[model samples]
Target: MKKNIYYFDNSATTWPKPECVLNNLKYFLNEIGGSPGRSGHRMSIAASRLIEETRETVGKFFNYDDTSRIIFTKNITESLNICIFSLLKAGDHVITTNSEHNSVMRPLRFLEKKGLKITIVKCNRFGELDIHDIKNSIVKNTKMVILTHASNVIGTILPIEEIANLTFKKNIPFVIDCAQTAGSVPIGINLGKYKNCIIAFTGHKAMLGPTGTGGLCIGKDVSLKPLVFGGTGSKSDEDTQPNFLPDSLESGTMNVLGLAALKASVNYLLKMGVDKIREHEKNLITRFIEEASKIKRIELYGTKEAEKQASLISFNLKNLSPSAAGLILDKKYSIMCRIGLHCNPNAHKVIGTFPNGTIRFSFSYFNNLKQIDYAIEKIKEISRIE
Candidate 1:
């Protein structure tokens, strides 16, 4: 008999995507094959229409009125890089949290070398940020404030709405990396109230879409220079890049097939409702925490409360390295999860798990209580041997 693989790495990328997404991926490839916004042919027009429909769907999902403000990228990393590279200039100060993923860290580090001042506001060991510390870090020349919506390593959900409000009042552009919280948590997209905010999202993770589907929702007041310049299907009469919302930023052949998959996935979420998804994941987290807390020698990280976190947990055995434990879970128990720094060494350092990271079990809505029980039992068994 084939071993049943129990996947618990939804924070990295969700597995077993919605049937609609898979069907559309095939439909786009087989029936509606064409490059979006590249030509005026029938196939191209169909592709363009599909892209626009997806944009509208995304805009509605985020509660943003302007559909054109939604710009697609390969992933949240690319979306963040575009915002970081376009907004900051020489001698500008930017504020961020220490718990940020490398997607936010690497680009800021690259900019810091070129006369950009960076302030890393410290989060608690639980990965919770203090809003006052963020406010205190802001200065006269603060160009932007970029932060992650949730810690991908420890699953702590940061207070991004409060941060966005603060940055809006300060006239500083707030860029939120929502790779971990987009489809799992509620992202306030009140563009009228918070005009200087951008929410960057990846579709593959909680959105239940394929890879290469991600984008940013830009506010009206924020202006960003194009990171890439090429054909935008519009304003072809001039060689200059079009000075518009999405056309100015998106300048290449788009991933129409992937977007079709994303559209279907987002539609599924919309129909099912994000609130329901959040409730289900919270129940799973609650169960995992309750069960794992009973086992001796199992050390868990972050705020031990499920309400204060996303749907994930990070922990370590008393004597086992995260790598070794991950191997045991995979080979011996047929369990799958993420290990190591989770691309955020800074998060590990903050959580006091640096050098050797913790094993992360990130759950999705599809995961059931039985899986959590089995995982806890296996973890208990591992803890006993080690």
Candidate 2:
């Protein structure tokens, strides 16, 4: 194994987080160790303030004003599960794309077995979704439109704005999985208008926060039942769940330490500006794609254009299984990346890489052209391995 590691797996979780995140985590652990919304002590009040401030920062980050609707979860998977299991009933119909992660698919499939109808609109091999496809798929009974803002497998960005507009006109709930784009790309929904939209985001990825931190920015028009019922500290006198925005969804002791770090991370993003980070990652993707295209055995996937996708690229080296190549990349070159179907077999099938998936390089703002060049060089060397 090589000593120096070049991380290209931001889509999974971002490593080398900003210094502020770590600093805040330490600060919370050392000083403010109390459960938010659970007590009246000063420590508890401080913890609650951290969470509310983090909620406010997230609201400004997403350009949404309603901070009370921001509900935190352990990860985007939980946020998505809350949306899927709470909003849709047995007879309800939901629309999603074939490019969704298991977070969306698994819950929907679970409901499908119980009589819920699901429509998976197929995207092009490049993972590009046509907004018209979603429009055409909408039915009279369609209760929700749930899909990813970007494909976790291919890094292809979907037309969420158009889809949100369409769903808004139809008066249907629109759920967006922002796991891959939350910190890297600007979330394009104007909540004032598209009040039916729900954006699920994770903190560990591009947000540069620690794991066990993620949340859902709920729209005004959308109301979901509590997925986990417990003590929200509010309406604790009643045993039943609270019929409110965040309290309705958030039930338990909030992750105050994680939220403390998340607040710092989001503050960092707001300070650095997401557009600048996006531009840097786009440059990495553009350079990687350009170099990888020149390699003899490399078969690039997705749109092969930086502008068309997120900050990641998927490709396969001819005569090399993704698993084998990934192992070699890890052991020989210290290049960390994700391979195989990336937990989304539907996306792999769409791109004709099912069973044998492509090696995915998910870049981050911290990654640069030098790392991209090195990875491409390593891939070139790996391609020659007979």
TM-score of each: 0.98, 0.98
Q: Quick one: RMSD of model 2?
A: 1.4
Off by over 4 Å in 2: 1-3
Model 1: per-residue Cα lDDT at residue 301: 98
Candidate 1 clashes between residue pairs 3 or more apart in a chain or in different chains? none
| C-alpha lDDT of all candidate models, in order | 0.91, 0.91
Off by over 4 Å in 1: 1-3
Q: Give the alpha carbon lDDT tens digit for every residue of 327-374 in model 1.
A: 999999989999999999999998889989999999998899999999
Name the lDDT value of residue 258 in candidate 2: 91
